[model samples]
Target: MDQEKVNILLVDDQPAKLLAYEVILKDLGENLVIASSGREALEVLLKTEIAVILVDVCMPELDGFELAAMIREHPRFQKTAMIFISAIQVSDIDRLRGYEMGAVDYVPVPVVPEVLRAKIKVFAELYRKTRELERLNHELEDRVRARTAELEASTAKLRESEQRRSMAIAAGKMGSWDWDWISGDWMWDEGQYRIFGVSPEDFEINPANVQARLHPDDVDQLRKAIAEFNKGTRAYETEFRIVRPDGEVRWCVGTAAATMDENGRVVRVSGVTVDITERKRAEERQNLLAREVDHRAKNALALAQSIVRLTRADEVKAYVNAVEGRINALARVHTILSLSSWQGAELSRLIDEELAPYSLGEQIKLAGPEVQLLPATAQTLALALHELFTNSAKYGALSTRAGRLAIDWQVDDELLTLSWEESGGPLVKTPQSRGFGTRSLLASIESQLGGQAQFDWRAEGLLCRLEVPLTRKTAAAAPGKFDTAGSAELQRASG
Candidate 1:
């Protein structure tokens, strides 16, 4: 449907005239629509809009004058030009009649082809000019629509920009500022006033007023940063504390960039400051927790090293087994402490874990108040309990079928006292000298836990008492005294 390109219609009864017209107008480079009768010409007009019409005057039934009159009756062809071509001579009256039927020009018989071509060319150029004007009008309308859309978008963008600034301040919980050093004026938004713990009316809007709010300890550092900025530093960034007017201290971070003048001097500084007090406090707490974990880990490793150094064994396998057992007792204490987030461990729990191998039915009795020991104390007490169980198993309570053991403890204020008694076995006697297990047990209770240990060996059985403070941070506080149980002995045992 290219309206810019159109066809020329030729109506004649003979096929020869139609062929001649096609050959003559081939050089015009326009399409030619041919029809043999008035009825066929009307059909062509219905299908296509043509630039001009050329009709033969003498036809079989419907002649050129009749067809031209019919074309004039339709309003769609009002602007189309019609020409008459006859094969014979015609009278002036017939020519006048043809002009009355809307004929623009009359072509005589055997007319010159050039004259016909010249007439058709004029009308074709008019058609092309009309179509070109229409295309130009459509293009102009499209451009106007695009420009209007762009203007609407710019208006919306300006409105959203204001809203975006407010949302940014609320989400980030930060504030912006612009300092015009030339005017000595400071700009503070709502967020900035909140960070400084001041109201808009209370702020003086001057550099000196801002300087007064800076913490005394950090004022010099901020001054140095400002001095560097004034000297043309590209970036300004620092962290400092601010003492608000309400007497509250807060951590803040400042970042800014200075705008320079043509004279190479700082003219304005635009920046933001964020309140970071909560973040700083969280970081401090994390550091403290990490240090505490490191200290405890080191202490546990040192205690293992001490066990390896102090244990006396003849074979490598025996030494490893003994050390592994002692370390396992300490690990059990740690596990109990972990259940309470390392706050403390229950004394009864530690004792039960260490004596799990010994079935406590008739021969063993355990009685104690519910007492929670500190982490270090629990670890040391576990190993000491292990040594006590080993001693009773080998020579004291469990050596005979009828032997029995009784353990009981009581707490009074800061003091925790424990007693262990063995009976129903051979007559009790003290060793000639202290062995590795005996010395380790005494050192663990007295040196590590700041506790006192006393052993009494009677002829019938053995009795021991242990008294430790409820809260002893370190062994260096005070050493507990150990009393010797000087009695008879058949074996030099190490308990």
Candidate 2:
């Protein structure tokens, strides 16, 4: 790159002296400005940045001292280099006065061209160096600010990551620990202290203190796991129980990894212990449910066998239909029980399900308070209801459009009394012999449910009243609702 030029101002009352000064400084490769008077020179200084100013001592209007003083007083030109040029010999006192007015050098008339060029070149180069240093300082400050901002952002991100890690560990009920096997040194974080149910101030962090809290039966298993880890095993896990100071037992699963030294010895161990008490309890409950389900399945199969064996049918089709109908009734009630987690079934829901096919306008009117029956009671009632509805559709109210079946139930103390009345049907007569359907209904209510079933064969219709003794287990079950889609509305008698 080429060197940049600086401006040098020449101020004289005579044109000849101004031309002489410009010619002498032209070979220095700097910009030279000419002004014929002091007033003209001041105007030039305002427009340009002059590095060196050469003014004549004998001026027509403003003398050298006066002009230099005026230039020095102006803020912009205070640091500008000024040299006085006089045609007459200057006394020492006059030179001192010129220096005080900011004259840097004095050049006598018939000045040496080489000496004047050397002085101006020094001052011009000094100004360029000062400006370059200021620019570099500004750049250094900017870089420092940018680096400081980057460090602050990185620190904030790291803090957020650590906070998230801590929250996850706490939520999972996990604790961490580190031990130096060689030095017998132990270290545990806050989570470890919390898991053991001991405060830091009350408990010492050592193997003896930790072992004292271990359940007697689980200590051996833990010892075996640690022994395996010491024999060059990188990973090992064990499940154990801990008895807290307050005698609360907690299940925990521990997993650890060992660091090996050059001699293949275990030097350090790091691990985590997680509370698994809830998981263990859930597993126990699942096992109990499995056994309960197996027992219930066998009972259902036995009930189906009994229905098939005792059913008296003249044809294969009759036998198949009777068996299928009873089985389907069992399945429907089973579905309801499953939906409620085998807790119980609602009495109203059971009635609605069995009467779904026969429901036509107001052909059936049912009124009952909300009642929940235990699993066994629900199953027996489902079969009984199926037999009643089948018998009605064949010979009773559901056989004709004009006939109607009205069923209602109420609970008083521990007994639930339900009445099934068939009105507007053919004239009723007492049967001499009981069929299998009537026998099955009577057996389910009396033998299985311990309830009484009374039949009234009047001239108009058959009215059956069932007095069922609800055990504490049955009436205490909480009432539940299931989706009985497309079922008729039953009258609910609030109690």
| 1-495: candidate 1 lDDT, tens digit per residue | 644456899999889989988887777888899999998998999889887898999887888888888888999886688889988888899999999999888887696789888887777878777767778888888888888888889878977886797777766668889888789778889888888889888678776788899999989977897899878896788999989988999999999889899988988888899888889999998898899888778767777777666666767776777777777877888789889888888888988887787775688788988998887677777777777776677677767778888889999987889998988877766777776677767776777677888888765667889998887787432222221111111133433
For 269-300, candidate 2 gives per-residue lDDT tens digits of 99999988899999989999998898778667
lDDT for residue 483 in candidate 2, whole number 0-100:
13
Which ten contiguous residues of candidate 1 have the minimum total lDDT?
Answer: 481-490
Q: Could you tell me every candidate's TM-score relative to the true structure?
A: 0.61, 0.70
Candidate 1 TM-score, C-alpha based: 0.61
Write down the lDDT of every candidate, Cα atoms only. 0.79, 0.80
Task: Give residue 233's lDDT in candidate 2 (0 to 100).
Answer: 90
Residue 325 shift from truth in candidate 1, angstroms? 4.5
Query: Of the candidates shown, which would achieve the greatest TM-score relative to the real structure?
Result: 2
lDDT of 1: 0.79
Model 2 CA lDDT for position 428: 69
Instruction: Give the number of the best model, judged by lDDT.
Output: 2
